[model samples]
Structure formats: C-alpha cells, structure tokens
Target: MSEYQKPLPIIEFQAQKEFWDGCKKHQLLIQKCRDCGEINRRSVRMLCPNCLSGNLEFIQASGKGKIYSFSTIMAYPPQGFQDDVPYVVAIIDLEEGTRFRSNIVDCDIDALKCDMDVEVVWEDITDEYALPKFRPLKQGS
Candidate 1:
C-alpha cells in the first residue's frame, strides 16, 4: 500500500469548481484579481479585495512554495481525518506571493520548518475531488 492515508471532508460549494477541476489533473490553482492582478486562494468573489474590481481569473499554480506557517493538528477533524491525526496542517507561501492552506504529508511531520522548500502534490480524495498537499521534495522524486 502507499504511504498515504486520509479520511477526507465533504466539500460542497459551487464557487470552488475550477479549483477542484485543476486538482483532478494534479494542478494547483489560485484566484487572480483581473483588475488589480493580486493573487489569492479562496474563490469567493469577482471583486478584487485590493481594488474592489469585479474582474477575476483562476490561474494554474506553479506547485512550488515554502512553509509560511504551520501547526501540528493534534485533534481530530470535524468528521473525517481521524487516522491522519497529529498531522501538520500548514499555510504555504507560494512563490507567487499568496498563501495556500494544505497539509504536508508523506514524511515526518515534525521535520518541517518555517521556510522549508516544498512542492505540491495532488491527492485524489474521490472521483470528483482532489486535495492539494505538500511533500518534501527530496533530491529526487
């Protein structure tokens, strides 16, 4: 069996379609304000938070980033994610200057650092959804 393990949460929302779609193909995506050119994570609105312009775009992410901040989850997730307890949940600072909230999997969780170099990975949680996680990119994958 693969070293991966997860019991995922139920994601129900119409706005997150594009983000979910990219994950199916192992691609990370983020929102860009078509008006001011600012990047963000959640697909919340058409208006740019910075300039308040109703123009936005979803762009494919580079899948490379650094650990901006993180916390080791000691408690169980609301419904799913019991087996994966004690895992590291982190906010990654992308090279593009936006932050992504995802888990750092596939290695010792305690080994992570505040500015560690990490790469994106797509974990297929179901037929219709994939979760973007991170793995320590070793010398070779």
Candidate 2:
C-alpha cells in the first residue's frame, strides 16, 4: 500500500455534491439561512437550525479562523488515517462567526493552542476533489 493514501469522500447526496464542488475549486462554501442568516458551519441539513427555514444559500467563506479547541491524535486513528497518526483535529471559529471541524496541517502539533490563528490550506487528494485543511497562521500575517 502507498505510504500516503487519502480517503475519498462519499458524494452521493446533493449536499455533499455542492460541498465537494466548492472544494474542488479551492473555495470554502458554507450554508447561510435565507430567513435568519444563521450560518450552518458543520452539519449539512435542508433547513436552518435557527428558524427551520428551508431557504439556505451557499456562500464563499473567508477561509480564516482561530482554533477554538483541538486534539492531537498520536495513536489509534481510524481507517485511511493510520498513515497520518500525528495530526491535529480542530474546531475552528471562523472569522465570519461560524465554526467548522477540520484537520490542522503543516504545523507542529505541540505548537497548537486554543485561540491560535489559522488559515485554510487545501489538500488536493483527488483529481476531482480537495480537502480543506487548516494550518497555523504565520506571525505578522
């Protein structure tokens, strides 16, 4: 097996389709409710979590955030992740006032901390898809 095997996402549903489409283009898209403007950052649902509005629009995110909380996985990772055992999984608080759960890459896990600034880094795993990962923002950036 290859040392670096990336797992592909299941994009059989419409929501998955839209999300993956944006990722393929290196764009970060999030759903915002048309009625209440509540940004649904993590879960993909048909209606708004706030007002139960079925009108949700996908908008491009700024791709900037801070690590609210995180965990460093050094062992016992799931399938397709065993190759990347020492990785950071963070709940990022986006500048747009939403939170997203993503992997934190391109940095030492020991340097991670709560409220540390981070920026999105796209990992081109497949010809038709890319995963949106985050990394620590450089000083003075």
Q: Which candidate number has the best TM-score?
A: 2
| Cα misplacement distance, residue 28 of candidate 1 (Å) | 0.9
- Could you tell me the lDDT of residue 63 within candidate 2? 94
- Which 10 residues in a row give candidate 1 its minimum summed lDDT? 1-10
Q: In candidate 2, what are the lDDT values of residues 1-141, reduced to their tens digit? A: 234366678766687689889998999988999899788855777778889888988989999999999999989998878878888888999998888999999998787899999999998876777889999999998
Model 2 bad stretches (over 4 Å): 1-6
- lDDT against the true structure, per candidate, is 0.76, 0.87
TM-score of each: 0.79, 0.87
Where is the poorest 10-residue window by lDDT in model 2?
Answer: 1-10
